[model samples]
Target: MNQTQLNRMKDGLGFIAALDQSGGSSPKALARYGIKEDSWKDEDEMFDLMHAMRTRMIKSPSFNADRILAAILFEQTMDRTIDGLYTADYLWEKEGIVPILKVDKGLAPLEDGVQLMKPIPDLQKTLDHAKERHIFGTKMRSVIKEANPEGIKKIVDQQFEIGKQIAAAGLVPILEPEVDIRIPDKEKAEELLLKDIEENLKKLPADTKLMFKLSIPTKPGFYSELMKDPHIVRVVALSGGYSREEANQMLSQNSGLIASFSRALSEGLNVAQSEEEFDQTLADSIESIYQASIK
Candidate 1:
């Protein structure tokens, strides 16, 4: 979490394929990609498929980390050994890709239908382990399903609190507070979201190092303040269910918010394609997303 690493985290397109999806999420995501659940009889089968997808992306002949600055990984994937190297180190050594670990234990329902991350099992211990493995950063997620001020504040507060702990351990924290795209009044919600976050941030000591992984703003430039904030190392946008084309369009219009996309990045990749075709599809996706990030 030194300046060099912080600069890299802020520098290029981020791929977030780290999905330790719950039972419900797995099937729905598979279905979205036209994968049939019956093809996988058990959770282990599904996980094998998930791991394959991410590893394919990493090892693809067309894989380029020049624009793919970092990759966030599921904890299980972090431990995976490929070619005698831990996956994190493998990515770093082979592609110059900094690997980040997904540390949250998924979400639990909160009051007013909001959600917060379930308690991470031994969070400090996990951070220590990640640092030892040379993982560059950590990411945790919470949701803002509505525009309620209270809910937004709660998300920001909790993220900053946990983020401080991660930063103290010398790992950068990617604080993701995703605002669900289904809601109307998204522009108003963005304004309130930034306002609340900014107010809370002011109370922290001036040196709190953090980063953001937010939903694409409803309006262009909604996150201008964040981009200008010195305490923030970077501001990245989540695709949040947008199609690849739509996410790229919105991302291009915004200044300073680079993509840390998960589903959108995986949208066109197919396990069934010929190797040449698959590489071309992946190359095209990475180049397009990379272009948007530089803009």
Candidate 2:
């Protein structure tokens, strides 16, 4: 593991940029960027456009280490190049931002009020490649739609089991068991989630550290205890479906948790904008999230 990168992640004052939208989510991301379904002919071209958007975001002046601690990338993005350097290398070498890869295949069908991650076949190979390309860590996600104790426990167990494998491969793992923000019993679900994650943290190996990406809780500071856990490197909040203004407002109420936003971070950016307009929009987004993170 890169100790310096780990330390930065643990103590950094900024937020993580979630640029890892996969095939399932890329169309919506592209559409939001002012590209529609008619623009791309097939899957490959679709992904290429998505990559172009990510590349543009990374190359922007505001997407630097000062207010951006790290970026979570899709596997293809990690494999691609930015200005002649591999994506991960460019992030760390040129911009001083750490790079983390999204390793989950996506989610399984919702069962028992939760959706576990789909199996990641040949995960070891992916981890090995991430290390070779200068990746500092990995992020995987599962979702909880209600307060089912059994389902939440299963999700946490699977995440920690996979997290152990990631740790064994010499990379930190950000285990995201995101509770649905719109669920009727959101607070109950978060309560159950907190218990399950706490139990798993107790069982984790002494040397294995983990990060968490969760929905902003219904109750402010609800995750404060988790932030203090010795085995937890950091606890971050996902924007889930919140608007940038809403997400930032909630994030500022949680003193210790930082942001790891996808759509919210890209909200206002569109392909039609001029280069100057695009950069200014991105800079504004970064600044708002950065201020919320430091609160």
Candidate 3:
């Protein structure tokens, strides 16, 4: 992240994504990662996590500079039954806040049994569902990640359909292309993939935010092609899976904004005994991201 990037992050929309789980893994994963509470099984524990998460956000004051503060969500993880969705600022037509609902494979059919990894048609359905249900962020919704070029096209195609239908309803489609950088060399692959993204974005909604999730061989060069596109809104570098520093560095490089996961979720792994644990996490997440915004 650079000074300019820092400015952009502090001044624009940003978020930390959440897991999309529909299994025991939901609770177990949060716990395994130490981000959950023993009360994960107990209502009090669930509420505690929620309180901590939200308090953290408030303390962080993410919206102070007009930045979008939120827990991004994937289809599998959007199950509100647990402590996840209740803390959302945008649920049910609320204002100045909203959860970034991640449109995962669940919205679209795929070759695999899993919904989190497949491609979906139009992400508008999720946005609409949020509105009908009065979920916050009533005016917008964002999507992330398609494994490859084909997946990118699938996502853009859906956004295009929604774009054409905006008069009837509206949603913001975010294209998250998970970039697996080839440390030593893989320019050809990088170019090939970024090219597809550039071309697709040209035909999608003008409001669409394109994010590049790059890990190794860190540099904007990996996404050199896409970054050059006039419409690309943000380029985020993520190492995924457990390295909070990786994400922080990615955001810190530009002094950009980041969404914490591994560590936040890790709280659940320690077997939270009660609500206090959950409350503390939320309060921490909000503060953590706030710091990122200022960094």
In each prediction, how many residue pairs overlap at the backbone (N, C-alpha, C within less than 3 A)?
0, 0, 45
Candidate with the larger TM-score of 1 and 3? 1
User: Tens-digit lDDT track for model 3 on 1-295?
Assistant: 1233334433455543443332323554545545635446675455445444433433343333244433444442234433333434333123244444555443434422111234445656765774444332211122233244454455445444443443235333344433333323334434544565556667755544344433322453354445556555444443345354445545554544344343433333233444465446544554554455345
lDDT of candidate 1 over 1-295, digit per residue (tens): 5465567776545544344444446676666555778979888888677677667778887665766877888877777776788988888888887788889988888655358778887999999889888888899899877778777788888888898889889888889888888888677667777987888678767877778899999888888777888788788888888888999999989877788887777777676777788788888888788777667
How high a TM-score does candidate 2 get?
A: 0.99
| C-alpha RMSD in Å of predicted model 3 compared with the true structure | 7.5
Which candidate leads in lDDT? 2
Per-model CA lDDT versus the true structure: 0.78, 0.95, 0.42
Ranking by TM-score: 2, 1, 3
TM-score of 1: 0.92
- Stretches of candidate 2 above 4 Å error? none
Error of 1 at 20 (Å): 6.1
TM-score of each: 0.92, 0.99, 0.55
Tell me how many residue pairs clash in candidate 1: 0
